[model samples]
Target: MDQHAEATGRTPDDERLVCARCGATADGPRPTWTFSMEDGRRRYFCDSCSREHLRAIEGRLDSSWW
Candidate 1:
């Protein structure tokens, strides 16, 4: 298991890492991106979705805005 999954207490086989935007499932080794929200919530994103919304993410814009 990767460090992120281990730290989060979730195994790779677990489908808990799901993209908050596109609803894509992270069933592989790891998620494409993991965002630590200001409210202390963790959000996951798939590769494609991450690339598509990179600007918004970096700008700290909510997924709902995209």
Candidate 2:
């Protein structure tokens, strides 16, 4: 593991996640962020966007429907 991964307990992939909703980028794992799998692809959502669509997310709705 790299220094950042060891320090943050995040994989290299986690260091460059882009929010599916807002395009917000994160360099580390965020406790409040959300991760989802859609159409066989991985997706991430930032805290604000996740909160904004909490209900939809809880309902298992796709981001497109939110």
Best candidate, lDDT: 2
- The weakest ten consecutive residues by lDDT in model 1 span 1-10
Candidate 1 lDDT over 1-66, as tens digits, reads 465553443345664666666666654546356654534555566778879888988888876687
State the displacement of the C-alpha of residue 15, model 2, in Å, after optimal TM-score superposition: 4.4
RMSD of 1: 6.1
Question: TM-scores across all candidates?
Answer: 0.59, 0.74
Q: Which portions of model 1 show Cα errors greater than 4 Å?
A: 1-15, 28-31
RMSD of each: 6.1, 7.1
**Clashes per candidate (backbone, < 3 Å):** 0, 0
- Candidate 2 lDDT over 4-33, as tens digits, reads 433333446656756777778777678999
lDDT of each prediction vs. the true structure? 0.62, 0.73
